[model samples]
Target chain A: MRRQVMDWLEERTGLETAVNHFLYEDIPASAGWHQVMGSVALFCFMIQILTGLLLAFNYAPTPGEAHSSVRYIMTEVTGGKLIRGLHHWGASMMIVVVVSHMVQVFLWGAHKKPREATWLVGIVLLLLTLGFGLTGYLLPWDNRAYWGTVVTTQIAAKSPGLGAQIERLLGSENGVGVVTFARFYTMHVMLLPLLTTLIVGVHIYLVRRHGIAPAPNDTAPKKKFFPGQVFKDTVAIFIAFCVLFALSVFLQAPLGRLADPTDTTYVPRPEWYFLFLFQTLKFFEGPLEVVGAHILPGLAIGALAMAPFIDRGQLRKVTQRTTAWGIALLAGAAWAGLTIAAMRSTPPETDMHAGLVDAPEWQSLSPEELAGLGHFRKQNCHACHVLGEKGKAIGPDLTASATKRDAAWHIAHFKSPAEVVPGSSMPPLTLPERQLNALAAFMLQLKPGSGASLDSAPDAVVNGAMVYQQQQCGICHQANGFGMKVGPALNGLASRRKRDWVVKHFYEPQMMVPGSTMPPYRLPKQQLQDLTTYLMELPARAPSRD
Target chain B: MLAEDSETSRRRFHLGVIYTLMGTIGAALGIPAAGYLLVPGSSNRKEEWVEVTNLEKLKAGEPEEIVFRRNRKDGWKILSEKTSAWVTKKPDGQVIAFAPSCTHLGCAFHYDEKHKNFLCPCHTSTFDLEGKPLEGPAPRALDRYQMKIEGGKILLGAVVKSQES
Candidate 1:
């Protein structure tokens, strides 16, 4: 009965014949494990589609709710974390697989002649994969998403005369805003997928039209696709997918703090896959920026597309095609070297597990705790004590103190420092009831390895640190057994002078200390505050028995 | 002939491995996706006592509707939903609170001061001073909220449904 039904369907649709042709087609016996990359790429694409569809069910595209909705998927929805993780990691996996497939095809001289269309379409598909990443990146609407796209669109804006137009087309005419969100969402979920599907259809059709490229200079008999080639492809896909699943299980996709357009302190970095391009742009700044931002990338992609035509020689062997092989190898090495350099130079992402930067924890701080952190900085508490990686070690490290003391003790200490600890160097804070509670609340939360350091410090302090090094303040003033003794020692300077005196000294160096021929430094008031804050960190002198 | 036999055996082994690998991958994707798609039944949120109004505001034997905002964690959002409850201070210095909704149809019910009874406007469901059904289509007595008084403030907990009028 089933045979008759199949025969009826076959007669009507010719489906069985197509399936038989697809399953039993002759592949070159020379085709081995290396040739499995194309099928593995196809598998990665399928995984992306599956996970992407699942993610679409929960993701909201609106600016206000996008970040919160992603948080909901991670924390609230059932198995949503895993699903989103798979989708997130799956994107990177697809890029890796597609690029590997392209590399394999190029090196094997599989892109020559009849398969040239296949190779060109594959390039288009690679661009689509990258397009997917760029668009999908902004959908989360977090700080990273907002800032990264700002940088990326700015890069696009560096395209010579068409810069502004390209920038407007990529992002909103105004900036990254409501319109940009809508445009990115549309491209990520709808436009890119549709274009990719159509192009991939053409790509696969071309692949089948010209059967698998025979191994270079091979005369071995062809093998059936059903068992040998399919088996190898299946194994490759299985291993690739297992690795993807492991990553999805182990490493969560990053969702940074909510998008803060006002946050100018953020240093935006692109996803790792695009880091090579980003790193290249770093080298060509100012007038030559166009070379790194546009010309180089454009020329590289253009050269890649014209590769088959450039090396039109009939020989496919690597030894026979020395010049082409040399160029490809050199280009690949340069690209890889740039990517590695970028990875090493760029700051590690604010991953919770990375234990490097705890920006997310700052987001999770309670209102009172956040206010307390504010008071700590505003009070210049770091001048006397170390907390996390910031602050001087003049007093007790607050991280250890926080672990040892309770909130009550912290509150009492903040209120009357002398009363709480006899002969304590800390001045009586004498803050209001609310501020006292908040300061204590903030102090009690500090612990060793909290990952609060330079990034978390208010921008002024960070800028001050940079300015100090830039101005070479250490060249004259001796501090901590470093630099020259041309000026007064900086170690106990904070105890001897007030902040006002330091500011006055910067403008009129001889006024604070007579007969001191120090050069008066002219700088902006903000820079002066930064420099003062930087200098005010001198260790206080210990009490001497009178 | 021997080489052909060996090749056939190798193909058979490969076929076995392919099936096993495919099965493992299918389960890896399918299990999570199935869990993701099939949302479980809504579980109850942990009940917390929230301040409603001061005891001074509740007159003896009179039900005063106290409206307050309750902050609830709904997914990633903290939503402040405005909720109301019926509070009565007994002549004996005891306080009783009833949920604002009608026991029958979940409509907001109000105290009909003229009749000195709780009334559901939609169905004219009435309950007496102790929340016993006096008239109309209420299925049971009005639901009472677990109540406590702390520092002169009346605190209310999750609603407790009455079995009988």
Candidate 2:
């Protein structure tokens, strides 16, 4: 019955004939493992489309909600970590596969004669892949994404006469803000995808028209592609999938602190693929920055696009293509060298990621000190000064402020910044004496390695925060502005229950709150106590505005 | 044979006409889309004076970093952005406000009290109190904001690029 149905469908649409044409074509006998990269790349692209569409369902494109939405995906969605991880790793995998395909094509002199158009289209696809990377990176709206884009726009703004115009077009007139986010989202999910899909169709058509490039001086008879080359391609694709899946499961994608427009301290570094270009910019300073920014890169792309035309020799052997080989070798070495140099020169501090709020020692602070922390936030002190790992590092880090200055000095410096320390960029802070005293006290307590345990106050509250983060309670319950709203807001939990009751609730969530989606947090006694104390203190502590 | 050649020439001409029609349609759709994308980013921003601080608050010959918020239209959103400038009240009562970004690569420059110069930490680019590039990779003097003293309040306008060294 199935065979009869298939025959009927084939009679109407010629679907079976088309399948036969596609699957049973005569491939060059030389096309074995070497030709599998193209199929592998196509497989990765399919994965991207599937995963990207899944991501688009939940991803909020606006600047305000993009970070939170990404966090929502990572923490709240079912199998979100795996899904997002696959998408993240898949991007790099796609780039790797696509580049390998390109390299294989280049080395084999496959981009010659009738296949020149195919090579050209392949270059466009390669660029579109990179375009996908560039646009997709900003969707998370994290610190790295924000700063990396700033660097990108700045680089664009340096391109000779049309620099500012290009920057504005890429970002916006005012700078990277709402428009930039929308622009990138549109490009990533809409424009680029559409263009890439259409171009890829043309690319495949050309590839099919030309068939696979034969080996240099190949004498082997052509063979059917059905079982031999198809099997090799399938194996390669399966292996690629395994590697991608393993990476997705093991190494979760990083979500840095949210983007801060006022942050000038962030050292923006591009993704690894663009590191060579980033390093090259450092060499060409000031007037010649245009060379590194646009001119040289432009020339290279131009040369690559015109490669088939430039190297018109019929010979396919590497030995015969001396000039091409020489140029390609030098360029490859230089790119690798620059990328390595960039990697080596990157500062170690870029890896330092900290929670958005609350340092470890905050738990040990007096009420006055806690109030001072509030004052610090209210004053927007983080715009310039870094506390713990949070905030910009434009000014001296406040983590070791106590070791550097006495409370009296700090107070004096706050009152008359330039007078206390000449050439100080700190503006004159004219606060009431009480607030100043609280701020000074707060600063005095900030010593390096001053853990919450060091002080007598129930600083275990900070330790409780650590427990909360480690336990991933934020995935379900939100306190203040952090975490999702899947469960009840923990803002006024103390009002809802006593400490003992809260601790009991943690141990038996379903028992306390029937139909609670949250599973019981099987934490140690000390952790429960700390967590309860943190909840108890939540009422007194004001909700974070940011 | 001659009649056949004429027929082939007519066919080629028709194909050329078809391509030109297609090209015209493409341009009609494409040009506007390109403009739509580019125009928003490339619009000339109008400069307006915004009150920064009271003139009395700034000490003479000393630079004070003044932070203020400006409501700027960014695409569909009107966002209030926090921006700052290094304002120096000259001994002669001439208030000069330097753009916070350094002339070299736009990193935030801090006024170094010990060196009595503006220094950018990124490349160690230094500028004197007069905004002249004194040391390092700064290609020009520090750019200054156009300022007008209205009554007792110091208002800053557009940033004016300084002459390159």
Give the winner by DockQ. Answer: 1
Q: Pick the candidate with the highest TM-score.
A: 1
Q: Over the full model, what C-alpha lDDT does candidate 2 score relative to the true structure?
A: 0.75
Per-residue C-alpha lDDT of model 1 across residues A1-546, encoded as one tens digit per residue: 999999999999999999999989988878788889988988888888898898888877899888877877776788887888888899999988998888777877888887888999999999999999999999888788999988877777778899878877776668889888888899988899999999999998998899988866688888898877788889999999989988988988888767777765567888889989988988987899899988998898898899888868775665566676677789789889989998888776553222112233443343355457767777889887755556665555465447478889888888888898898888878667767876787776675434353227555644554455456676777554445778776756777889999999999988777888888888888888987875566333111111
DockQ of each: 0.27, 0.01
Q: Distance (Å) between predicted and true CA of A119, model 1? A: 1.1
Q: Please report the TM-score between candidate 2 and the true structure.
A: 0.54
Chain B TM-score of all predictions, in order?
Answer: 0.70, 0.86
Clash count list over all predictions: 0, 3
lDDT of each: 0.78, 0.75
Q: Model 2's DockQ? A: 0.01
What TM-score, computed on C-alpha atoms, does each candidate reach? Answer: 0.67, 0.54
What tens-digit string does per-residue lDDT give for candidate 2 at A1-546?
A: 999999999999999999989988988877888889998998888778877876776677998888776766665555565667878999999988998898777777888887889999999999999999988888888888988887777777877889778877787667789998899899998899899889989998998899988877778888877656666776677678878878988887877767877655567788888999999989998789888888999888788788877767775665576666677688889989999999899875443233222333454354455555656666888788655434554565465445478778988988999998899888977888877876787787665434222233344665565466556666777665556779887866777778888888888989988998888887889888987787677643233233
